[model samples]
Target: MEVKVKVWIEDDNRNLVFGSGKNEILKYVELTGSISKAATKAGMNYKKAWSHIQVLENYIEDKLVITKKGRGEDSGSKLTPKAKELIELYNQLDEDIKKYSQKRFEELFLKKDELISLKEDDAS
Candidate 1:
């Protein structure tokens, strides 16, 4: 068997502000410095990626990315300090949850051999 985990944050109004997909977009944008490039890397369209960022910003009531326009080479998106902090916190939370879930899953479900042996003993 396998285990999967997903984590996200919601605003006071219960609107989702951050999650795996958005996190990937944010990380990629930070790495590539361009929303368009990040969206391409993430297999999403520019519009969708921009929409996601906008939703997150609205939910959090903060601007997570600084956008620059024009055809200059320096034109690109950059993550705000708030965005960086949020990404770091979200990543840490994701790691902790994955570790906890894996440990619990092993304890509860990965002992099939032991369970089978116990069943055989009971049958005997």
Candidate 2:
């Protein structure tokens, strides 16, 4: 089956923020070692993105990213252990879901035409 999968956490504002995006931000933080650069690549302003990170940290009850004062371009931002774990979890969950979907729908359900027809009719 051709299924699309999505995973996210909803905020107090009912916003569906993706684990993937946050993970990418963490990756960029590690690569560039700057929250500012990470936020920019994520198409977010630094302060606003920082605020979002803060919200997530509060939700998880742990610090995700840490920033440091730069001494003439020798310092920047980095992801904490919590952040790495969160990202790894996000990736693992996503993979598991995808695998399950393929096994359940594409393989197992492919032969179940009667059930699929009923579902399609109900949708229409």
The model with the greatest lDDT is 1
* Positional deviation of residue 77's Cα in model 2 after best superposition, in angstroms: 0.4
Residue 33 Cα positional deviation in candidate 1, in Å, after optimal superposition:
0.9
**lDDT, each prediction:** 0.88, 0.76
Over 3-121, each residue of candidate 2 has an lDDT whose tens digit, in order, gives: 77777767778875656777777778878888889889989888877777887787778888877895766567878898888888888988898888766776654564433543655
What's the TM for model 2?
A: 0.73
Any idea how many clashes model 2 has? 1
What TM-score, over all chains together, does every model reach?
Answer: 0.81, 0.73
Which parts of model 1 are misplaced by more than 4 Å?
A: 11-14, 112-124
